[model samples]
Target: MVFAPGEKPGLEQDEVKLQKASKQIVQTAILRALQQVSQESQQRQAPPKGGPSLQLERGKLTKKHEKK
Candidate 1:
């Protein structure tokens, strides 16, 4: 389709506007996904709080001898 001489620039401007809007939308989606992944990773890496502590002792046990 051939547009009138005056209509060609308008069509180009509309296309440019559409492209800009699409780019903005894609950027927003990527940022949101990245933020969500970061939050999830942080949550997973965090240690649990208020838990019991464990201790290990190294020793040798001696058996008691009983005499009749």
Candidate 2:
């Protein structure tokens, strides 16, 4: 493609602008994904609330039937 001398600079500037915009878009997407993963990991690390507590009793395994 033969571009006129006056149009060459404009085309170059447009190409640079497009490259910068695309880079910014990709960076933003990556940042958002990282943040989401960090949040999910934090949630998983948190302990459950109002759940059954586990304990180890040091005695024989005998079941005492309770009168209900």
Model 2, residue pairs in steric clash: none
lDDT (CA) per prediction: 0.71, 0.72
Backbone clashes, candidate 2: 0
lDDT tens digits, residue span 1-68, model 2: 68876776478889999999999999999999999999867755663455532332475544434455
Global lDDT for candidate 2? 0.72
RMSD of every prediction: 15.7, 12.3
User: What TM-score quantifies how close candidate 2 is to the native fold?
Assistant: 0.58
lDDT of 1 by residue, 1-59 (tens): 78886787478889999999999999999999999999867755663455532222366
For candidate 1, give the lDDT of residue 55. Answer: 28
Q: In model 2, what lDDT does residue 17 have?
A: 97
What's model 1's TM-score?
A: 0.57
